[model samples]
Target: MMRRLLVVACVLLPLPAFAHAILTSSKPAAGGSIAAGHQTLDFQYNSKIDHRRSRLTLTGPEGAPVVLTILPSSATNALDAEADLKPGAYTLRWQALALDGHITRGDVPFTVTAP
Candidate 1:
């Protein structure tokens, strides 16, 4: 019957809410500190992400947000970017789209100390 078929289809389909990527770990960690100047930012996720579609935004000491360039050689489930920071509070906001086509985002707030 149509009702039974509809129920089956719903059961078979994967839930979108559960397929979103989660930040498992990150370099310079959240609320963590690092030295000023050139640094590599890394973000590891719970699932494989589309590096080409993912984004990393850095908010520097001046309170302006800049879109970081994603490194080409980074791993599938990880995002890596390079940044030159100054001594002040900063935040790295990231957005990732997983293999399942779900997008997830979060922020990493940290401080840049004098080298």
Candidate 2:
């Protein structure tokens, strides 16, 4: 019975964890472009996130990482911020913490064009 118990444990452990805060959608999508000026950044996840514990970092063409302040929102599974962007490339890095205690991170690369 030991072998059978081990097989059952392995099958159960292989299940996917739905607690992860997966990035479902985003504004200024990956490999996308936006108009240069004041832009609102938004990120959506599959699970409810703890906005207080999350972070948004903006890296512009100059290669400086600026930590953005999270805007308050009624949406529990999203993050929002604003920044003035110049005509160049940028990467928006997002680190989110799900209510279930899982943390997820990803980078959204895009460019800004002169309006």
Candidate 3:
């Protein structure tokens, strides 16, 4: 009986780990660069996220944090936004809440160059 219960617990414990939202990829990929001007940001996650509860914050070269608008998503596991960038360094901080009520956050630091 103990052996059977241990096996069940092990199986169920790993399931919750899969529900945490993890940033799998990004548009201006971390440490990458983009052209200065209107740009679209895309963030892909490993699990389905609650878009309504997620947030994206952008910090420009001047060190001011601006909250970017979260656009409607066609893909359930991705978040998208838009912003007008100037030539400088920038960091996009993302906070995502998974369907299972877990919150995950990450940063994508990139630079914008004059085009």
Q: Each candidate's lDDT (Cα)?
A: 0.87, 0.85, 0.87
lDDT of 1: 0.87
TM-scores vs. true structure, each candidate? 0.84, 0.83, 0.84
Worst 10 residues of 1 by lDDT: 9-18
Highest lDDT model number: 1
Backbone clash count, each prediction separately: 0, 0, 0
**What does candidate 3's lDDT look like per residue over 1-115, in tens digits?**
8757645664477574446788888989999999999998999998888888999999999998999888885278999999999999999999998865667889999999999
Q: Candidate 3, which ten residues in sequence have the lowest lDDT sum? A: 9-18
* TM-score top scorer: 3
- Better TM-score candidate (1, 2): 1
For model 2, how does the per-residue alpha-carbon lDDT over 1-115 read when each residue is reduced to its tens digit? 8757645654566433335688898889999999999988889988888999999999999998999999996278899999999999999999998765657799999999999
